[model samples]
Target: MRARALVPGVPALLPSYASLDDPVAPLRAACLSAVGELGPRVRVVASGPSGRRVGAALAEAVGAVVVDADETGTLVVGNGSATRTEKAPGHLDERAAGFDAALRASFDHIDLALADELWADVTCLVGLPPLADGDVRYDDAPYGVQYWVAVWG
Candidate 1:
């Protein structure tokens, strides 16, 4: 099934790991930004001017190995599986007790601006990896808003 078909309805809280304070990037790099392997449920983050470059960077990052990443887009590389919940921290912390702690840990210090439904957090790609699940790759230029991603270890 198309990963987007399995979009989760529960409200999610992990905002992009990137921030506006990011150094200005060149246009060509932004045009080819990689969206990475979000697995089954790819939340297409609409990265603005730097969309292409960010996506390309993310795609390369996805191709590389990632660890302790419970938020941002969970890339399912190689043969691995993870359990995810509506709460982001719970998914990361080995000892997360409930939703509140999870939320605090996940969104702590992260800047959040209200985006349309298009900006909702992505969830539950499970065993799918970008190498195998390329659906998360958006070949086109970003609509404008690129995502800031962070891997909380």
Candidate 2:
């Protein structure tokens, strides 16, 4: 079995929350492109209902199906710290950058407590396979929030 993608649970990705200017245009495009790579049937792993909704919307946009059982591809929705800078959602935590860096290196042995403190949505990332250099499709801190879109086979 192979995991298809790792996308952020940013509400802006959804059409319902879209703005007139579309602040996350590039990120949204990258996510749709990555999600489109997964074959029709996909399993979604998300942190909560909102995350699941984002995954479902993406799947719907790409003509993919979200399956509950027996799936070859999995779509995991989550993100790094929301406090990368002063304008970040969690508002500037000095430790946010370093915390996100460690997560980017390896999802193994994460300090859950610290993750919560930093406002990282890593609930679904805990069990994912280690990320490799070439697997990353996007890695940037837009809106002062660390977001990544990666694929793993």
TM-score of every model versus the real structure = 0.20, 0.95
lDDT of 2 at 50: 94
Which regions of candidate 2 fall more than 4 Å away from where they truly are? none
Worst 10 residues of 1 by lDDT: 5-14
TM-score result, candidate 1: 0.20
Per-residue lDDT over 1-153 for candidate 2, one digit per residue giving the tens place of the 0 to 100 score: 565699998888888998999999998888988888887888899989999999988888889999998776789999999999998988999999999999988888989999999999998899677677437888999898899998876
Report residue 146 deviation for candidate 2 (angstroms). Answer: 0.8
Please report, as a residue range, the 10-residue window in candidate 2 with the lowest summed lDDT: 127-136
Q: In candidate 1, which residue ranges exceed 4 Å CA deviation?
A: 4-45, 64-153
- RMSD per model, one decimal: 15.3, 1.2
Instruction: Please write out the lDDT profile of model 1 over residues 45-115, one tens digit for every residue.
Output: 32232332333344444353323333344322110111223333223333222322332234332222221
On the 0 to 100 scale, the lDDT of residue 51 in model 1 is 34
In terms of lDDT, which candidate is strongest?
2
